[model samples]
Structure formats: C-alpha cells, structure tokens
Target: MRMYEIVLDGELTSDLPATAGPVGRRQEGGSTVLSVPAAGRDALEEVLGLLESLGIGITAMSEVEAPA
Candidate 1:
C-alpha cells in the first residue's frame, strides 16, 4: 500500500472512521495532518470521500515517499 499525508483545515473532532485503515494523526498549528495508507488511487479516493462525508475539509494531500 502507498502512504499519503493529508492536511485538513482544522483539527478533527473525532478519530477517522475505521474504514480509513490504520491512520496517524497530528496537529500542525491550526491544521491536522493525517498519515493514511491505501492500496491504490481508488482506495485513496474512497478515503477522501469518507473524510468529506464526515465534514472534514482537506487543504492538501500528497503521497509519501518511502525511505531508501
């Protein structure tokens, strides 16, 4: 699975749904950063959709490169 870093506009009031898979969350200033792992693009899209449905706003998203 590929790793992605998603930056939300603000801190999430609750943890991400289990469907999002194992995720890491941290607060960066006023924004919340989430480390999400997905099998592919489609899976990542699904996670994004789920976040939207939960009223979370994404400010930025990018794949995380693995260390050599």
Candidate 2:
C-alpha cells in the first residue's frame, strides 16, 4: 500500500463534510490538512473530488510508499 498526504488549500477537514475524507484530521495556519495514510491515487482522487464538491482547492499533494 502507498501513503498519500494532501496538504490542502484553505480550510480542508473542518469545512469538509462528514462524507469528504477519511479519519485523519489536522490544521495548518489557514488551511486544514487531512492525512490519508496508505491510500492509492484513485482513493485520494475520490477524497479530493469530495473536497472539491465542497469548493476546496487542492493546494499540494505528496505521496510515499512502504518499502518494497
């Protein structure tokens, strides 16, 4: 499995509805961040889409994977 942590733009989790993301939640200066560990691109995108539906911009994205 792979790990994908999205540092979203503006408030992410707080403003995000219940159906937006997974169980991780954190907050940065002006943006709320959610850490969806061990998630694939498709899964991440689906979460991102849910965020978009709430009118949140995806500021940045980072990916990591377990040692093979």
Candidate 3:
C-alpha cells in the first residue's frame, strides 16, 4: 500500500466520512489534510476525484512514507 497526503483549501470535517480511502485526518493551518492509504494508483485517483467533486480545492497531493 501507499500513503497519500491530500491537502485541501479549507476545513472538511463533515465531508471526510464520504471519502474513498481516508486512513486519518487532521487540520493543518487553514486546510484539512486527509491521509489516504491506497492499494494502488487507481484507488488513489478515485479518492482524489471524490474530494475534488465536493468542490474542495486541492492545494497539494504527495506520496509519503507509510507509518511503521
């Protein structure tokens, strides 16, 4: 699995439950960050698309080292 960090433009506490592959979540400054552990590229893209459809502007998306 791969871990992805998706940073959005604003808070998204209410929208998280509907996320495709969120493993964790938290607020970073003015944005809501979602930690998504995807099985592959297809799954990751699905999650990103879902979030984008909600009108939340994605500020950043990057692959990160998974937790130990």
Candidate 4:
C-alpha cells in the first residue's frame, strides 16, 4: 500500500465519496488537502477517476513515505 496526498483547487466536504478509503482532509489556503492511502494501482486509479468526475482541479499529487 502507498499513501498519497491529493491537493485540490477547492475545499471538499467530508461526504465527497462514500466508497473512498479513510480520508483525512483539511483546507490549506484556497486548496483542500486529502490524505489517501491506496492498496494498489487499481485503487489509486479509482480515486483519480472519482476526482475527475467531480471536476476537481488537481494542484498536486505525490507519494507519501511510510512512517518508520
């Protein structure tokens, strides 16, 4: 599994995706930061598609290092 930080151009409500993985969200300036962990490539793609369907602009996306 890998952790990802999906930074969006706008703030999102908690109920964005009911089937999404455990998400941690917060607003940073004018953007919303979503911390999502994916089990594999399929899962990651699903998240990306969902974001696209919602028409959310992705400001940034990067893998997060696992905690030691």
The prediction achieving the highest lDDT against the true structure is 1
lDDT of 4: 0.76
Please list the C-alpha lDDT of all candidates, in the order they appear.
Answer: 0.78, 0.65, 0.75, 0.76
| C-alpha root-mean-square deviation, candidate 3 | 2.2
Residue-level lDDT tens digits of model 3 in 1-68? 56888888888877554435445778999888887775566657877777778777989988888778
TM-score for all models, in order of appearance? 0.74, 0.62, 0.75, 0.75
lDDT ranking, best first: 1, 4, 3, 2
Off by over 4 Å in 3: none
The digit string of per-residue lDDT tens for model 1 on 11-43 reads: 876787677667778899889988776455665
* Backbone clashes under 3 angstroms, per model: 0, 0, 0, 0
- The total of clashing pairs for model 1 equals 0
Q: Tell me the lDDT of model 1 at 16.
A: 70
**In model 3, which range of ten residues has the least summed lDDT?**
14-23
Report each candidate's C-alpha RMSD, comma-separated, in the order given.
Answer: 2.4, 3.8, 2.2, 2.2
- Error (Å) of candidate 4 at residue 44 is 2.3
Q: Is candidate 1 or candidate 2 better by TM-score?
A: 1
In model 2, residue pairs whose N, Cα or C atoms come closer than 3 Å (at least 3 residues apart or on different chains), thus clashing, are none
